[model samples]
Target: MTISTEMLWLIIGCAIVTWLPRILPFIFVRALTLPDVVLRWLGYIPVCILSALVFESLLDTSGPIVSFHWSKVLTFVPTLAVALLTKSLSLTVITGVVVMALVRFML
Candidate 1:
């Protein structure tokens, strides 16, 4: 396959468009001092987003009634325990993945 100049420029443009929004905020915020309340609230954003994602995956809401995904719930038990016990993100993720793999393998 041959690459066209127009397609190359398009790719470069797309890269800049995708990168600007992510990089611009940090560049602009570097010099500014955010208020303590704002900083505290920002810290909760990651936890809230993570919780939302985890809970969404754990429950099945496609039908009329919401139901729990037993396999995920089973995986979650050890994962949550590891997270609380170690307070290590890397270890918690490893535990979750390994536990889920085992659950899938067993069932």
Candidate 2:
């Protein structure tokens, strides 16, 4: 469907509002002194968010299963172990997604 001019303007305005908060940090990061604790937490936020998302997607469902899905457990348990051992978020997520997809396709 074609968007109306008013709707287009609203979307543009919303985009600007959404972007300013994210942009403001980079714009001001150079001019400020940051607390070490706050900076460390900020560094961790993305990994925490990613793990939360992966956990929910892997483990949360509307109904119960007879036994835990072994393949999902197989995929994610190793993913977490590797992530912790190596301290690599990207590798962990990629392995989890790939292994789960492979197991799903195989069975």
Candidate 3:
């Protein structure tokens, strides 16, 4: 298949649009030195986001009452343990994946 002129420009435009936001922050922030308090506060952002995502997936709120997904809760126990004990992001992710696979297999 041949690429059309319009399609090529469209692709380039999309690439610029997608790349600018991700790159602009670093470029702008590189020159400025953030204070210790702001840096410390920024550190908690990832943890807060991850916790929100995990908790959202672990509970079912479709009905009037909230309910726990037992399989996810079971998987979370070991994953949380691994995260706390190892303090390794990779190990925690691996533990969560393996435990989730096992839970799905057994159930």
TM of each candidate vs. truth: 0.62, 0.49, 0.58
Question: Model 1 compared with the native: what TM-score?
Answer: 0.62
Q: For model 2, what is the error of residue 75's alpha carbon versus the real structure, in angstroms, after optimal superposition?
A: 8.8
Give the per-residue lDDT of model 2 (tens digit) for 26-107: 9998999999999999999998998888666666465685444567777878788888988997988888888889888998
Candidate 3 global TM-score? 0.58
Model 2 residue 105 CA deviation (Å) reads 9.6
For model 3, the superposed segments whose C-alpha errors exceed 4 Å read: 1-18, 31-37, 59-68
lDDT of 3 by residue, 22-91 (tens): 8998998899999999999999999899899999999988889999998999999999999899999999
Clashes of each: 0, 0, 0
Comparing 1 and 2 by TM-score, which wins? 1
RMSD in angstroms between candidate 2 and the native structure over all alpha carbons:
5.2
Candidate 2 residue 25 C-alpha distance from true site, Å: 0.5
**Per-model CA lDDT versus the true structure:** 0.95, 0.83, 0.95
> What lDDT does candidate 1 reach at residue 66?
100
Q: What is the lDDT of residue 23 in candidate 1?
A: 97
